[model samples]
Target: MSNIIETKVCSEIGDIEGVILHTPGSEVENMTPGNAERALYSDILNLSVAEQEYKQLKQVLNKITKTFEVKDLLTEILEINEVKESLVNNICKSENVKPIKSSLLSLESGELARQLIEGVPLNKTTLTGFLSDERNALRPLHNFFFTRDASMSVYDHVLIGKMANKVRERESMVMEAIFNHSSKIKSKTLNPSSSKHHKDEITIEGGDVLVAREDILVIGTGLRTTTQGIDFIIKKIKKNKGKHSIVVQQLPSKPESFIHLDMVFTLLDRDKCMVYDPIIMQPNKYQTILISIDNGKVKKIEKQSNLVDCLRDLGMPLEPVYCGGKKDIWIQEREQWHSGANFFAVGPGKVIGYARNVYTLEEMNSNGFEIIDAQSVVDGKIQLSDYEKYVIAINGSELARGGGGARCMTMPIRRKKVDW
Candidate 1:
């Protein structure tokens, strides 16, 4: 039998070979307007509509490459008694629900996996449980569908997320468990929790880190990721002897839409990138800095003009496609808030994003990208291979309200090398 999982992601625009996805479950419906903000959601999503839109992306990916579902992977890992006990213990400890450890241990792998993600209902038999205001022993992972945040695959290793929010920390724990213990995967996970360098102030998420090339990384620091987190990544890169570069873009702390780098900047192709000009290109108080590592030691750290200019100076010049079009900043800000800038590359020049951003799609069409509806591709009405570069537009009116796009919902593990 062949190994199903081999981690290798050197570039954002490589030909994707294997990726992980988590179809939104009842966990999404498990939220209420009262606590949605605490869950990092501005608004509760219509799970039915979101699932329909997600299916198109899922079907297209399934047809193009190998795809794994989180629930399935978790189920497989739980079959091993030792792994099951260990994961349950870690979760119980992290959430301060040690009393539920024995209860969770008794569940079979399948049910346990479901409860872990969807949430374990509180047992009202006990006096404390009955009197408690909490509705669950384990709160639902409301943001798990945006799988990109919990764990990141970077050059043969997985960097488990150190979530900025306590509510989402379990997301990282579950992802780390899946990658570390799943028989289907074949790579080691590097968790900040295990590092002596780990500190409560350090925070990193997949959305803020992008592998521009094998030796170059683009990271964002703001509400979701901290400067300390970038320092941790630099230390990790120093362990390997090579010339490496990390471009750090400081983001605004307000407007939750600017939560991560991917929210405003994402690679669309080897020579093309999607960007929100206000943050990535235009002059602003936020600074863009570059750190260079040579032979396992930092050689220099200096400020750069902007993200686009910095990349150009680094030898990979990308044609900027403004999100929500360049005609007006008001339109750009509006669509940017709705996740118009987020795009996920399936191949060198092929990508996927929300179709609701009409201005952005028009810009893509004007710039040599053929627009193809995701539903048509899923229904066999069109063939993706016919176009050399095209954008698979998925319906996301409801999903975008959840604060992410295709890139946020999927985590790529393996990709064919990009020929630049």
Candidate 2:
């Protein structure tokens, strides 16, 4: 067994110690055009191409810090007979596939892990099964590669995401099981379902939550995350005795690109942030609210002029870098649609993003960010430590179509404390 990795993430740009990643697999290709919408995808992905693109991301991270694959972690915990039976039973009951419980339990740990993720083929022996159009008894988790959505590390605890869509709920279940039962991980899980304040309407995803500082959080609420979900987090903070602030940004319900805050806004450095102008800077009807908590009680809640200004008042002032160049709105919209603003910070002033956003890359360059190709770093042609501030650009021609960027693909498990 590997050494236990405790969950500790207090800031977005802290030096990463360990992170969780899921490489694109058969599950991503399992979707067809017929069920693409149901799987939360606008289009189907080419597994081969996606795999090639994902390799750049995986390799780059592997070189920088310890990385754990979801399948490997899940498989390790499944080797424990009790954990396996319990997880299988919970999944079967949740998905209403109890009939397959015994069958699932019979498989070896490795095979069982694969089947759990790749999906279980349906048996046509029954009349209903033969007549059904469904291809699998339990549907494949197409969005599993976006590992940031299911669960997130908050300080010393893991917050199990309550997925907005029913189809993605199993992803959360699998993640919760891994965190709760894995002997190789040390952390308590905070599940909304188990909370006394839990409600059916509460839904939160990892992509919507960003740890700005040890005492501050930035959360987005829209299609994927609800207001009630933010309230749940507020309640959790109320239990802790300290000053805490949550910056809530209301998001657009349409144009799927705005599904999460990270898609339109992400921290680039201690004093810099990437943003899509239309939604974040040139704001419209969307509102930014600041909620402050002190000594286990609600101190104040009020509307803010903008996110940047709000954070500035709270002491963390940041300069905004437009997603595309400042010249054209058309270019900004185009690149932002493909996740131009989504950059994952490995450390302060050090990040990763898509190289396809030429305009966005140009903007970053103008703002003193040295752009480097991901392959160069992976192949040892270039050393990342040589640059104090650089954005490692990965080829995202195919991966971006899945509706996320570098931040959407990573879930930080442990990070070194920032000397602020």
Q: What is the C-alpha lDDT of each candidate?
A: 0.92, 0.92
Off by over 4 Å in 1: 1-3
Q: How close is every model to the real structure, measured as TM-score?
A: 0.98, 0.98
Candidate RMSDs in order: 1.0, 1.2
Worst 10 residues of 1 by lDDT: 192-201
Checking candidate 1 for backbone clashes, the offending pairs are none
TM-score of 1: 0.98
Cα lDDT tens digits, model 1, 1-420, are 686678889999999999999999899998888889888899989999989988878998987889999999999999998889999999999899998899899999999999999999999999989999778889999999899999999988999999999999988988988888888888878888766765888899999999999889999999999998999999999988879999999999889999999999999988899999899989999999999999999999999999999999999999999999999999999999999999999998899999999999999999899999998888899988899999999999988999999899999999888888
lDDT of 2 by residue, 164-283 (tens): 998999899889989988777788899888756657889999999999999999999999999999999999888888899999999999899999999889998899999898888876
